[model samples]
Target: MRITTLAKNYFFYCVLILTLFGQNGFVYSQCPTVTNTAQSFCDTQSPTIASLQAVDNGGGIKWYATATSNTQLTNSTVLINGEDYFVDDNTGNCGPRQSVTVTIYSAPTGANFQGVCVTSLSQATPSNPQFVINGNNLQWYTTPNGGTALSPTAILTDNTIYYISQTNPDTGCQTSRLSVFVNVGLVPTPLGSAVQEFCNIPGSPPTVGDLVASGNNNWYLTSAFGIPLDLSTPLVNGQFYYATTVDPPCESSIRLEVLVNLYEPNDAGSNGNRSICVNEIATTIPFDLFNLLGGTPDNTGVWSGPILTTNGFQGTLDVSTMTLLGSPYVFTYTVSSALCANDTSTVTITILGLPTATVSVSPTPSCSGSPATFTFTGTPNATVTYNINGGANQTITLNGTGTATLTGTYTANTTVNIVSVAS
Candidate 1:
């Protein structure tokens, strides 16, 4: 029995040793992992992945993707659309590695988002000033190139160039923009011009103190309302009238007429003291006057009548024909024109009565070489001188006109000169 038990023990020990050696001799193989190497391509309506995948020997797998070429799957994660895709090790086949590609479709949901804006109209001095546009961040360009753009609120900058576009966001198709322009200016102001015309015989010379006054009927010195005007100041002969207003560039003007006046010589006379005989002619008096006051003439004045008119009613009056002049004769001289008229009074003219006297001669008649004497005379108060020749200032003592016989002359050859003196 003992020997049989020992043999069983040895056999069990040998079996244990053989099992250990056999386990040590066997080899285990591991599979490579799979990964994604590229992002997906667009196929019809969906996205399919372009790929590289890896399977590890321990039945683990990972996948990666990149936008760039030649990227290794070990360092990259596959992104489809905007979401990230990771390696799925759920079906683990260790030996063979598989590849997967992720596709980005429908353009990541929000690419190239866009909006439009317009500029506002701006107020300017000129009615047609320029309008400019401003926009938010965008990758847009002008549609028509070198003209003008429509901006945020339709406000414009002057003399600036621009380009506007009506473009699609996703696809870069655009519509053409018409050109726009702005200018600067305002409405112009209006103006008026004027002239004048003169009257009074056109070209004839005027008399002194004579005035030619114009009438409104001839369109002289007229207002816009056609009212007759007495100017604030007397009108000057050769000057024009002018007035103005301050609205936009607008004014008025008209031709005016200015009448001129003339003045006469100041020949009005004044009376003086004088005396005249019954048959003497009238003498002219001398005087002159003028209107020192600012008085103008009344055209239709009347003078007291029964007055004789000659030489424009300016002749001398006859006082010499009055036979009796006791208290002195008085007369008046009157002068007139459109300006002024007045009468001047004369001083008295007195007349004296005549006187009577007698005359005589000296020397008697005698032949030549013979002498005789004869004498008679009035009071010496009535004395006389005699002359034989007709010399003007020569005087001879008047012995008598018959004194030629005393001198032995044949006939009386003497004339008498009388001397009368009044105190």
Candidate 2:
């Protein structure tokens, strides 16, 4: 009975030993529990096998490329996408190890681009080139690897290679960089003077063809991008036009600003003729010579006629300083300009002299308050005016003999005077 009991206790002890240590007589610990069984990483991260181990617990760890492989892999060994990796404790007695699947994200695709150098004043910048990519959250960089992302408004170098990258919005995993070549074309030379001036004639106005330029010129109404204009388009005064050169498929991005100015020709109006009595010359007010002009004349023209005073665009005639009466004076008005020929007109002013008159009293020694006769001699069939005792005036007409008489009732100490003798 004692031997049987000792045998049963030994058999139970062996079973317990077998359960504590492994079948190979080595102590056993739990295999590492991979917190993340399925892992995803960007190719740019360069994940490795050691990245799969989650728990250490001071037991150390080992990585294998396959699930059923005895060969161990170093921490420096790179990981592949869609492949399973096995991880276990360094004890080497665990029954089964944890497995992990790695997923590597590739770089986004991008296409090459072309650009042009746009020049303005003394500065130049790239224009008309765009970077196209296939993924979300795209970014541009100067180097192929890690670097600061470029700004959207950053200027690109000509004929250079730029790197681009994209990121997954859900996973936040960024892909590797892709190269894009930018081929920038050369800028073409400009044509002619910026501003031009031409005369605006009545029958023929200035046109776009009249502009002075030399090249394969393409004219535009606006300074920026716009449709080209025809050569027959009429040029407005003080308007601006743009010009560019067409060098095959590549045109100049910088446009030459051409300002057009149409100048109106100077005008001197038609001739004028007038006559005025010398006695009435003092009463004649100063007048502008422009009123005598027949057609519409430009006010900027200078007046050159007799001795005239000018006030800005107007000329005043001075009729007070006239030595000769009953004579015709011709005043020539000329308008001159630098761009147009001179124009001239004439104004003939004639002054008339006062008529001569001789007065005689008839029926001498007449009584007071009696009718008296006054005789006047003047030009043939001329009219004369006389006043008695400073009373109201009376008129008298001369016949063919150039003589006339006026009768009036006079008061005591009456006086007779001829007011005017005119024909």
Candidate 3:
């Protein structure tokens, strides 16, 4: 809101004080006195006769655009910006006519200049200026009313304010210089936490933001979350380098955090190295088994050992060797990741505990003539067998989840024995 002005000094009409009081109202050879005055207004507005001080002190008043023009201004008049006008009295003894200068001021306003500091002068000049001069003839200066002209939007690496001037060309009036505080703040210092990777090229000096001190950025290796790493700190797998911005002393909020991106390899369980039950895979194994340890994902598996079969995480388990290998069976496979060369995971097979077998008979009493139903409960995916009075053994596969049932016709219920075997 700072303003510079060119103002006209005020003058008291000395002639009016003397002649109006005199007893002899003489139309003598006294000069109709005129006071030299200054005129100023914005280019958007017009000037008036009273504003220009165009009235005579001798009591005879008439305003004209020119010294000799007949177009008399009986009332108010709108004078052009920065244009001139003359006023005189022809009815009374008058003196030399006086000329008034019209001054059209250029309103050079400094708008809110909030911007990021740039590295170069060219970068400082924005597409749109922060300050605006209302007039067409606009000029920019480094110093107040000094130096060569510059663009209004220019930004400097250092924090400083630039001066600007606006001119009213129509009235030939130039306003005093106004200022636009070009708050050229260096892009908030890039802190180490802002980076995702770190090549650790010391002295080569990677650019980073200094969140602690403004306009100064430092490079540093950081922890997984971006905290600066200690000097000579050993880089860890799947870690990160951070880059953050320093807060300016005046502006506390100018801050930023970014990742440098480059720390590779995941930690311990990153590969597929977890255990799975052998019996759980009736038709296909769980897909997440590949990432049991941690992985690069998109991996494949090769079944080996007594099963001697090839498969994937979702492939069927080897039930044939369940009897020999028994429950809690162990197996291994190498699951690799993508992109990077060294991404292998761990996936193992574990046969779960076998469920016991239980038999339930419907129509328990001697059936007389109807067929009796024998229901067997066992581990999912296991085989169930039953003997009816030692007549013969009937085998049926468990529902792979629940119970298995068997039906036989007998005049009287002799005996029902059931057995369950799990792989």
- My TM-score estimates for the predictions, one after another, are 0.22, 0.41, 0.31
After superposing candidate 1 on the true structure, give the runs of residues whose Cα lies further than 4 Å from its correct spot.
Answer: 1-252, 264-266, 277-320, 341-348, 352-423
Segments of candidate 2 deviating more than 4 angstroms: 1-30, 38-78, 82-84, 88-97, 103-176, 179-232, 235-266, 269-302, 306-423
With candidate 1 superimposed using the best TM-score fit, by how many Å does residue 56's alpha carbon deviate from the native? Answer: 65
lDDT of 3 by residue, 136-219 (tens): 577766777557776555445445666656766545555667766665544543433333444433333233321233344433
- Residue 413 of model 2 has an lDDT of 79
All models: lDDT? Answer: 0.34, 0.72, 0.51
- Candidate 1, RMSD to the unseen true structure: 24.8
Model 1 agreement with the true structure over 73-135: per-residue lDDT tens digits = 443333454444334332432223344444333211111211111121243311221223222
Question: What's the C-alpha lDDT at position 281 in model 2?
Answer: 83
Could you tell me which residue pairs clash in candidate 2?
none
Error of 1 at 344 (Å): 4.2
What TM-score would candidate 1 get against the native? Answer: 0.22
What local lDDT score does residue 360 receive in model 2, on the 0 to 100 scale? 76
Best by lDDT: 2
Candidate 2 structure quality by residue, lDDT tens digits, 198-310: 87888888888777665567788887799988888889998998887664445677788889877777677888877777888888887777677778766676666556666
Cα displacement (angstroms), candidate 1, residue 123, comes to 32
